[model samples]
Target chain A: MISSIGRFIIGVFSSTGGVVILFLRTLYWVFIGPFQKKPVKLESVFYQMGFTGLRSVLIVFFVAIFTGIVLAMQTAYQLEKMGAVLYVASLVAISLCRELSPVLTALVVAGRVGSAISAELGTMKVTEQIEALEIMAINPVRFLVVPRFLALFFMLPCLTILGNLSGILGGFLVGVGSLNINPYLYLQTSFKYLELKDIYTGLTKSFVFAILIALVACFEGLNTTKGAEGVGRATTRTVVISFILIILADCVLTSIFYFSNM
Target chain B: MQRDYSQEAIISVRGVSKEFDGRKIIDNVSFDIYCGETFVIMGCSGSGKSTLLRLMTGAIKPTEGSIIIKGKDISKLRTYQLDELRKSFGMLFQYSALLDSLTVEDNVALPLREHTKLDEEIIKIIVKMKLSLVGLRGFEKYYPSQISGGMRKRVGLARAIALDPDIVFYDEPTSGLDPVVGGVIDKLIKDLSEKLLITSIVVTHDMQSVFRIADRVAMVHKGKLIQVGTPQEIKNSENPYIKQFINGLPQGPIDFFKEDIGILEEFI
Candidate 1:
């Protein structure tokens, strides 16, 4: 038992080290590689943007809008007794923007984009494609991982913004459609308590979440061994680890935002 | 089977050994490969020839000793230096390893696009030329999955020669193909060696290929060099292991079931 626990601890440390090295390598390629005659291709970055951001709009909308509706209904249930049901709009809008939208959108993207990247890279690793790239003098980290890293870093924040808007719309539907609240009053209440900092804080969390998803996914993919089984395992681990890190980061950021009054 | 010593050796493997998890996969093995020669390394599946190929490619570092390509010790080079050296050679994987997402033309043009400042139209012409050299003309629009296995291998050959490198290493070039297609690939390897003056190192267990392409052949068994000679010399070799391997005999000094020790442990 002790030996197994020791092994687990060592595994964690080594993998953490691996991820840090990958992160540093990606940063170097993005910022410094261009000056050294190794520019990152804009075409590759745009292709990745289409995959991560454009293709993901519908799923994010569905998830965020539904969460918004459920949230509005639940808050109104208790607020109805207090005769303050109008606060439901403000509550859903604030919570979704400050926490739910960023975390939820990241989780969805982590499931969709993160798993695909890991599985793709894992298959390449096993099949000698990555090795082929290496033999051709192409740095796999620069060629394969950099565009993906930059795409997630920028696009996740945009996705979170979309999620924030859809969620507010969902809450508005619940507030004005069935709850008999005036549409104008619902809009007023929603923005009355909401601040610019709330949306930006969520966007900030998304940027952090983007780093986590890209690093963990690419790290897992690049290190895949064995064969198809290894690729499947890497994909699963990417999703699980990204979800954990997203929630963990959200919790920490929330506390900091709360305590600092920013 | 005597070889002319006039040509200097381009690749020299010196007492290289590779170990994995405390187990030696490639024992101390040394050999010299001359410039513009097709040297075949043949061994059974678990015999570590693939590991040696990877070591020479600088994909993995050796546990001990050195691999020198054109007198520069590959083991000692920095990452960028190694990459610089890597651009001087190309490798063809058993599975072809073409990027599945790219069309055949894009795959062939990848090396040029990444490493050259050539115009797109110039690259397109070069891609067409390389594809035609491998007898794969007009198949440029197809992805790897859209082609036959034999065609994929030919496209892989086109990709390998895309950079016009001094050395080309092939892993199991004809492992899964009809005998006729295999002959075509074998012919390509020979033509590339003689016509392009390219040094070719092929790793395979296919006896037919060994005899067909190699100017000098090396047989490895259990991670150790058993014999190195011309096809005729290897055909006439008295070494029991080589004789057994070449003949595909069931009875010999080479025990077939000894490899099952690890598999048996897995079950128990």
Candidate 2:
């Protein structure tokens, strides 16, 4: 029994170590891969951007808007008791920019894009397509992982910015239409409480969260064993692990910004 | 044009062994494959024929001993060096391994595009030529999922031979095919080795494919080479395992039981 527990702990540590090595290798390729004789494909970068970013816009937008409404309505319900219902705008904006937009967007992307990445690469690994790539002398990391890393890194920030804006708009609609608050006063109050620092920190979190999702997904996918069942497991692990890591990272970054007053 | 199989060995494996989870898959195997010959490795399921092929191709490292390919010790080479050495090699996977996202032409064109500076026109011509070689001439725009299994295998062959490699490895070339389709593939393998003068290493359990295409055959039984000879010699082999395998017998040295389940227990 003790041996089994020891094996389990060793497995977890080794898996984590493998992921860190994969992450560092991917980062190295992302910077130096372009200078190689056969550079990483520019077209693949754009293709991943389309798949992971553009296709995700509508879903992210809708989720953000609804989250904003829920936040405003729930907070208004309480603020009314204190006769501070007009403060709903500041609450919604600050919450969206500081936490909801980045975290929720990452969670959604981790579910959609992260799982897709894992499934695709896992299928390739199982079917020997990755071996085929290696036999052809192409580095599968540069050929497969780098484009994905770049796509998420660049596009997640853009998605977060859009999500934040859509969320604020949703707050505006709920504040004026449902709560009967002044539109101009709500807008003024929203901007007054939401500073550039909030936007910067949120975008920064989104960027890091993007790297986390891509790295975890690619690592799980590349290390997939067995067959179809393994691919399914990898996809699930990508979403679950990405969610936990993103949330943990968000806590650390939020604390840093809080303590440093950035 | 006829070719000779008595040339110097192109690949030499010496006392190689591979283990997975302490289970021996390949054990102290040794052989030499000469240049410009279709060398077939024949074995029953779980005999490690596929694993041996992977080791030869440098896709997997052996646990002990050495595999020398074109005079370089494959196990000792760095990752990039192995990759550089792989430029001379091409492989057709058992399932074809065609990228589902790419069209037939693009799949065939991938290695050329990545490894060479040929003009797009030249690349298109070369892709067309390879497709023509594999009898996939007109299916260039179709995806892998859109093709029949035999056609997909041919497309895989086209992709594998796209770079005019000096050596090609075929893993179970006719495992899942009908007899007629398998015959066509067997004929293609023979013709390609002759026409291109490219060394061929085929891993299969198919007796007909071994007889039809192999200039030399290596019979593996439970991770050991029982015999290495021409097809006629293998057919004449008196070894019990070889006879059992080749004759398709129900009972012999090759046990059917996966585990030690008792006969009475199995029936119960």
Candidate 3:
């Protein structure tokens, strides 16, 4: 069992190392002489972002709202028993701004956009379309990856804001209407307790997560081997890696924030 | 039987070798594809036929040696240069790999729209002409999933010819088609090649298509191109591997049992 665990770790390291090397090579081509001059397909970028990010608004909105409501319900129940129902707003605000919003939004995006990126690029790789692009003097990285990376970089922040708004609205409905809290009091307390740093930190995490998700998805898709089976593996790996990375990043960022305060 | 040497070859592959992992798949293979000829690459499964096509097409680089397309060493071309070279040849994949999300017209129009400065109106005309050439004139809005495999292949052909490429590479064009459809595809390939005067490299094990359309057939065996000749010469060639493969004989130089041994051993 220990040996198997060691082998798995070694395998992951090698795989990651391979991906890094390929990514660097792609970057070199992207920045270098010939490839840089190739015309950027702006239409492809907008189309992909619209398909990957915009079309996913409903899913993210639904997930965020439900998460906020559930958090409010659970926290209000415990806090009310302790005669601290007013602290429920703080709990919802702090949690959403600090941890839940960014991480959950990333998870939702990974499920929606990450898989789509991997599958789209993977299928392109499988069908030799990527190769066809390369043969056409179009840099696959520029033609495929750059647009996606840019789309996700810009769109994830937008999704994060949307997620944050919907989550706050959900908590408001549950806490103010159902829990019979004073609307003015809930609003005042949430505003008072929530620091700008908390919101900034969440947004920063969303940015990093977006970059991570895009990199992993494009990397896996670009390097897809075998055929259909390879595509499936790439999609699975993108999601799993994005999920783990988001959590790890959240923990690290949280530590940084806490330590800075200390 | 010598091909005319005055006309410069469009694609010249010299001493190419490719290895996957540690195993050599394509070993020092060399060939020159002229501008207006149907060059058929024939080999049994796993004979590195497809790999050769990929190397020639610049899809994958040879580990050793070079591929020169139209006086440019494609293996040495920058990404953009290679892309320009790639535009010269349109490839039809074995599965007729039409993008499922795209309609037939969109798939056919993709290359023209991507690489050309032609207006959208002109692109549409080109798309229609190409599709009509392949007898898919009215199936513009149908997605790949909505079409039959044969229809998908025709759509793929239309896409391949959309840009009026100097060369077209068809990877096992008749692999999955019925005899009737396969013959139709072969005729289409022949007709298109003739009408457009485009050089074509078709990789296939389909013997009937080989006889029907190939101006010359190059038989690849165990990484080396064992023979290159006309269809008649290939039939008469005494190379045991060529004879066994072309005749589909179970016994002889090409061992079916040895191939099965690896799989059976894995199970055991």
Candidate 4:
């Protein structure tokens, strides 16, 4: 049992190391490889942006809007006891910007886009398409991973912003139409309570989540073994690991922001 | 068109051995493949023939010795250097390894677009010419999944020759095809080697393909080079493993199931 535990620990460390190396290589290709005469294909990056970002909008909107409505109703239930039910607008706005929308959008993208990336690359790895790329002297990392990394790096923040607006809109509808709060007052309360720091802090968290999702997905993908079974395993592992890492990273970033009074 | 002994060796494998988890997949194997000739490495499954092909392709490094391709020691070349060297070589995988996301024309045009600065028109023309050479005309817009297995293999051949590589490596080029398609591929391989005068290194277990396409044949059994000779010479070889492998005899010195027979006896 002790030896098996030890083996597990070693495996985790080794794979973590692999992920770090892959992340750095991707960063190099994205930032430095272009100047070295091998530019990342712009069309491919745009294609990935469409797949990972545009296609994910509807799911993010639904998740964020529902969460927003739930938050407003729950907060109104509490604040109504103190005759401060109008604070529901402020509560929903602050919470969505500072925490909910970014995290929820990330989880959604991690499920949709992250799993797809792993499955696609894992299939390619097992099928020798990756090896074929390498034999052709096209670095698979540059050809496959960099555009994905760039897409998530830029698009996840945009999705989080979209989610933020959608969620705020949901809260507005609940506050003005159902809760009998004045529409103008609800808007004012939301704006008054939502700080620039809150919005930026949330966006920052999303950027970090984007990195985590892209790296975890691509790392698991390129390291996939066996065959069809391995592809399935890698896909599952990408989703699981991305979810864990996004949450863990959110915790660390939130604690830092709270301590620094951001 | 025959085996050219006068030409210099273009690819040299010297005392190469590959190990995985302390298990030798390829023993100290050494051979040289002459320029512009068809050399086939024939072996049963799991005999390290595919691994040998990968080693030559620089996909994996050998644990010992070196692979020298076209006068450059491939094992010592850096990534940039390796990429530069690889531009001159093309490989056809067992499954063709065409990018599923790309169309047939794009697959053939990939190496050209990546490695050359040709215009779109020029690249399209080149793609058309290469596809025609492989007899895969009018399939340019189809994805890999939409094509038949034989057609996919031909497209793969078209893609492999897109860059007009000096040498082409084929890993089990005729493994899963019907005999007619296999024969067609064999003819294509022979024709490409002769017409293009490109060195062709093929790894396969099919005896028919070996006799049909190989100017020289190397027999590998259990990670070792059993014999390397002309097709006629290999057919007439007296080596037990080679004879057993070629004759498909169950009872020979080349038995692979010796390690687990007691388990079968126990079950029986």
Candidate 5:
């Protein structure tokens, strides 16, 4: 049992280490490659950001709102029996600000954006478009992955902020309307409990999660073997790996936050 | 052997060999492809013909020897340098390999967008001209999945000619087409080569295509070029392997099936 646990820990660290190495390599190539002197494909980047990021807003908003409402209902019902219903606002605010917003947004992005990245790139690799790019003296990583990585990196934090706001708004509606809590008091409590550190921590986690999703998806897509079967495998691996990494990073960040104050 | 009077050579391969997993695929292959000529590499299945093409195109490094493309040693070039060298050659794969997410115009414009400093308007014009060249002028908005195989091949041809590459590699360009479509593709290949004055290397077992399009045909057998001649010369050659291959005969140096007793008896 102990050996299995040790092996699991080692596996996680190694996978994360591999992702880190790929991220560093991507950054190195981005700065040093010849295309750095060329003007950025501003139009392409804007289109991709709109396609990959803006399209994701509806899903994130719905999930956050639903999660917040559900958590308020459950927490208010449970705490009311003990005359602690007022604390439900603090619970919802703290949870959404510190953990749920970033992690849930990542999960949603993994399902929506990460899968698309893997499939798009995997198909490109299969079709030899990547080879065509290389032959044309264009770096596939710069032409393809850099735009995607930048898109996710910039947008994940934005999404996380949107997610947190929507979640708190959902909690406010539930607390004031359904739970019969005062609106002004609920807002004051949520603000008092949710510190800047909590918001910063969640955004930091979101940024890391964004990097992890983009790196894993791009790496798997770039290295896809076999063909169509290989693409399906790469897509599955990207989502599963991203999901696990986001959750794990959330835990670590949460623990850091938990212990630092203690 | 006497050298045929023709245009100057653009690509020269000398003593090139490639091995995969300890198995020799292309061994001691040597040939020269001339400018503005349609050179066809013909061979039986599993005869290392495609491997030879890959080595010549710098898609894969040769295990031994060198391939010089227009006086540059491709094997000695660095990765980016190799990429720069490869810009001069266009490759059309057996599958059309059109990017599925991209429309036909975008697919055709990919090379221009990647390599040139041309404005979008000029790129679009060039793409239109290329598509019209391949007879795909109005299908610019369609994706690969939405098009038929022949249309896809036309789009592939359009993209192949996009950058006006000095050399074009067509790997079985007529493989999966009907004979009529295949003949049209053959005519297109011939016309395109003559019009652009570009070197073309077509790898196929299609005899009809060879006779229709090839300026010179080279037959590969057991990882060696057994014959390199004009189509007329190939037809008239008395080499047994060439005779057997061109005729599609089961007998001679090439085996059509295994000689296992049960299978042999069942066939009989």
Candidate 6:
């Protein structure tokens, strides 16, 4: 029993070390990879961006708009009782800009894009395609992982911004059409309580979440074993691990940014 | 069965051993493969043939000793240096390993596009030429999934020889095919070896494939090489293990059952 517990601890540490090494290698390849004979293909990066960002726009838009509407409905009810219903706009905007849009966008991507990355790569691993790449002198990390990494890094913030705007519009619609609040007053109050720092904080969190999702997905995919069943397990693990790490990162960064603002 | 010393040795495995989880997969084994010859490594399923092939290709490092390709120890080379070395080698996997995302032409053109500065027209011509060489000329626009298994393997071969590599490695080149299709693949392997003068190393258990293409055959048994000789020499070998493997014998020195000490004592 003691030996089994020791083995479990060792397994966790070694796995953590493996992920760290993969992260470092990815960063090194990103900066120094262009000078290599087989540089990261720009076409591949563009393709990844299209898939991870452009294809995902409609889903993110709809989700964000709904979240805004729900936030306004809940907060407006309580604020109406206190004769401060105008504050619902501020509440929705603050939640969307400072927290909801980034976190929710990341969660959506972790479920959709992260799972796809893991499954695709895991299939490649089992099929000996990854080995074939190594045999051909191609760095799989540079060839496969870097493009996804850059795509997520460049697109997540843009998606978050789009989501934030859609969310505010949703809140505005709710205030004016449903609650009979003045449109001008709702618009004014939405920006009245929000600042550039809030937007910046959300975008920063998004960028970190992008890295977390990409790294975990690629790492799990590359380490996949046992064939088809293994790919399924890796895809599932990518989603679960990305959720845990993204939330943890969000908490830590929020704390730091909150303290700094104070 | 005497080796031709005049021909240059392209790859030399010197006392190589490989282990996994404290279990030895390849024991101390050494052999030299000459340039422009088809060397076949043959064994039963659990005999570590694939592991040995991977070690020679520098896809995996050995646990001990060295695999020297062109006088460079592959085990000692850094990751980038290994990548540089790998440019001279191409490998066709068992399932063909074609990128499902890329069309056949794109797959064949991958090496040239990545490693060379040739213009699009030049790459197109080269892609056509490579495809034609493997009889995949008009199937350029098809994805791997759209093609039959044999056609996919042919496409894989076209891609493997894309950069005009000095060497090509094939893993189970003829497995999962009917006899007629298998013969066609064997002919292609021979044709490529003769025409391109590229050194070929094939890992397979197919006896017919072994005799049809191999200039020299290495028979592996339980992670050790039992014999290395010409195909004719291998067929004539008196080694019981080789006899069993070659003839597909049900009973020989290769025991089918693993008996405990007590079980063996009872039998005695």
Leading candidate by TM-score:
4
Fnat of every candidate, listed in order: 0.89, 0.86, 0.49, 0.89, 0.46, 0.86
The CAPRI-style docking tier of model 3 reads: acceptable
Report clash pairs, candidate 3.
Answer: A135-B83, A136-B83, A137-B83
lDDT of 6 by residue, A185-229 (tens): 999999999988889999999999999999999999999999999
Q: What TM-score quantifies how close candidate 6 is to the native fold?
A: 0.96
Better of 3 and 6 by TM-score: 6
Every candidate's CA RMSD = 2.4, 1.8, 3.5, 1.2, 3.6, 2.5
Q: Give me the chain B TM-score of candidate 6.
A: 0.94
* Overall local distance difference test of candidate 2: 0.92
CA lDDT of each prediction against the hidden true structure = 0.94, 0.92, 0.85, 0.94, 0.86, 0.91
Q: Give residue A31's lDDT in candidate 5 (0 to 100).
A: 71
TM-scores, chain B, all models? 0.95, 0.96, 0.94, 0.97, 0.95, 0.94
Ten-residue stretch with the least lDDT total in model 2 chain A:
A30-39
| Model 3 stretches with alpha carbons more than 4 Å out | A1-7, A18-40, A73-84, A136-138, B1-6, B258-268
Model 2 bad stretches (over 4 Å): A1-4, B1-6, B258-268
Model 1, range B180-240, lDDT digits (tens) per residue?
9999999999999889989999999889888989999999988999889889999999999
Output candidate 3 Cα RMSD. Answer: 3.5
lDDT of 6 by residue, B22-103 (tens): 9999999999999889999999998999999889888788999899999899999998788888889988889999988899
- TM-score list, all predictions: 0.97, 0.97, 0.89, 0.98, 0.90, 0.96
Arrange candidates, best lDDT first. Answer: 1, 4, 2, 6, 5, 3
Query: What's the lDDT for residue A161 in model 4?
Result: 97
Candidate 1 local accuracy as lDDT?
A: 0.94
Ordered from best to worst DockQ, the candidate numbers read: 4, 6, 2, 1, 3, 5
The best candidate in terms of lDDT: 1
CA deviation > 4 Å runs, candidate 4: B258-268
Q: Residue-wise lDDT of candidate 4 within B28-97, one digit each (tens)? A: 9999998998999999899999999999999999999999998999999999999999999988989999
What DockQ class does candidate 1 belong to? Answer: high
Error of 4 at A54 (Å): 1.1
Candidate 1 local lDDT, A1-262, one digit each (tens): 9999999999999999999999999999999999999999899999999999999999999999999999999999999999999999999999999999999999999999999999999999998899999999999999999999999999999999999999999999999998999999999999999999998999999999999999999999999998999999999999999999999998999999999998
